[model samples]
Target: MKEKVLILNIGRCAWGRCIFCGYSRENYPEPNLLRMKVDLDRKLVGFEGDTLKIFGSGSFLDDKQFPREFRRYLVEKCKKKGIKHLTIESRPEFITEDTLLDFDGIDLTVAIGLEVADNDILKKLGKGMTVEDYTRAADIIHSKGFKVRTYLLVNPPFVDDIKESLDRSVSFALQHSDSIVLINLLPHANAPLFDLWVEGKWKPLTREKFFEITRPYANNPKIELDVETFRFVPRFPPEKRANLEGVSSEILNHPHFRVWQEYLCDWYEKPKDKTIALFLPCSAKKPYSKSKTHTLIYKTIKTLPIFKNIHRLVISTPGVVPFEFNDFYPFNAYEWDERLETPEIKKEYIKVTKKRIFDYLKHHKYDHYFCFFKYSAESYIALQEACNELGVSCTNCLSRETYEALKEEKGNPLFKEEALKELREVLSKVKQKGT
Candidate 1:
């Protein structure tokens, strides 16, 4: 049966600081709610559809954004229109118990922003809510027997590794929501993310990378994923798109692309016999090896050659990426946390850091594990907790002088200045070598 859908514009978003959203593009031109009663009644006079998608340009349930009478009228109009079901655009916070009751008779499918599962990305995007918050909202939604529909943000900012970011996004959404909606971020003149884009900080994922990430989920016996997810929001139209052809196949098979297992490898070429390990926090620098903090750490470590086994690995959110392989693929070209301070995000940092740290220790026996991170504990708090849990003690080796010197020479090394420069450069080189 063909599903007839009705999209009704109900005002500007009440909470509209989402970094990717454009004020004029996503929400605006306040509709005269004075005529809302007569207008909606006329619009739905003889309307017949399976679904009624209401857009307030904001949260449909937020009374401040959409008046209570308008919301109640929506349900009344849908019922009068003979609509069997209704779907509405709302942020996570608006999906409350009382909100659900407002549309009790209709089969309600609440579309909430499960934007991205990673809290770090959420922080960068100005998405106020946390993953824990989303989980609670999702549970509340499901517990009430209301259908759950999630809107996932594609090509969200703060990561140079676009492909990895997409894969993580899809995987997270599939496990959480019933129907997955991939909303591709289209940058506009006044978009919050545009400022970051021009500064060479935030880059949208290309069409080529998007296809690569979607390929694996094609035949999965899970929930249906939607491409036309941005019904009310702006999309990356054809003319504005990057060329989506000729991505390297070797990249598809590379270990870096397969992050889950690549991160869990039991053995590498690094000498493990009585080795001295330098555990460092992630940097804003593209490759941690090139970062001033890392450079200083190397200089300090090299002074003592007698400490033979010098193994360096970065403590990053994408698991433990080896220091030597830092310049390879994603690690070399990607970006991560700049000033992460949320306690909510901190809990997540500990979970991933614990797994990668333990995996590193389990495979190799280091004579001494020296954590030289002089940054805030938020950066390496996971590593500390992980080491303690594993009955392993990591020494804090870097002195205050080294820490101060590292900060003095820091710069925005990861910023690419143009869209997809690092991704294209890395891909072109890798493709030429036939890897």
Candidate 2:
């Protein structure tokens, strides 16, 4: 398999003042500041990948002054290399009928980061274009016979109703484009919005909260929803933190932590013989962008013969492939939260899962539905409820027994000694408090 090559440019953001935007700082280095075209060409020459993706900072269309020579160079070089797919990004305002014509015969995919479809939210985020602009841009791109992709940013700032905003965005994308990318916002120090956090004016969403918010988009079928995140907290050693800052300790201890713990626990759990139906709710977090969890799932699935009998059904936005599982059914949800932790986030998580289960049962009934992660608990509960409604049996692998079994399997003598030390410290604290 040829490795994928990505030519990224963080564009000089046109809407540099959106309240929730952390990548909109005025002094951030522009693509024009670097030897962009030369670097891209150099990278392309050595890359042996089947796909050459020209992407990164600022919109491809934002650099209106980029020499036509550079564009021509990219096309001719890609054609010569026999690159299978060429991709680029642009803002809605930068796309027009004439702009589409410029690419002519180059085999490529053009994507625009529209973020949201609501005009009010667009203005709130300082997105320069409206829904109509995006629609028109999609029409123009499609008319040129190029694949059109739209990027939707769920749970943007100033948007009180997260679900409504996501529904509207997904609806718009489904109606307009061939594919949609759903990205959850992460606050970074470089964005204009970071100061809001520094000034205690804003609070970033936890991973759990973000998953709950993006659940709806994850389920959509009409368009693909690709989950990308800026947050990178390592689940294990040898995984260094990405350029993003550390997440809160509270988020670290959140209930969903058990989900990952349970996943690690799966190694010890005796593989059940029942027909397992894997239900993945839409998540704002993309495994490709963040953790090894996706890879772990793929590996686990391969090792367990149970997966052969498993029916995987994912409900999410259209665009990115959800998983390597054989059976997938996608659906759209009302909202996506980009934050990771909170009670409200948990509530929404439960609600979306319930909706998915209801939809699944109504169409196709299953023997038993097993959720791999805690994020899918809502779906699990819904399945339980559906079972109750129809008197069927449903169970999860991440029960208390599974956790206990996992602890026994991870029998590192050092780990046991550390636990004993921690226990002594805790008892000492209790004795001191009583005294």
How do the predictions measure up, each by TM-score? 0.49, 0.50
Worst 10-residue lDDT window, candidate 1: 426-435
Clash count for each candidate, listed in order shown: 1, 44
In candidate 2, what are the lDDT values of residues 142-223, reduced to their tens digit? 8888888888876567677777878877876877777787776655544545444334444455445666877766666645
Residue 259 displacement (Å), model 1: 31
lDDT of 2: 0.52
Every candidate's lDDT = 0.60, 0.52
Root-mean-square deviation (CA) per prediction: 19.5, 15.7
Candidate 2 residues lying further than 4 Å off, grouped into runs, are 1-7, 24-34, 63-65, 196-202, 219-228, 232-435
- Model 2 weakest lDDT span, ten residues long: 325-334
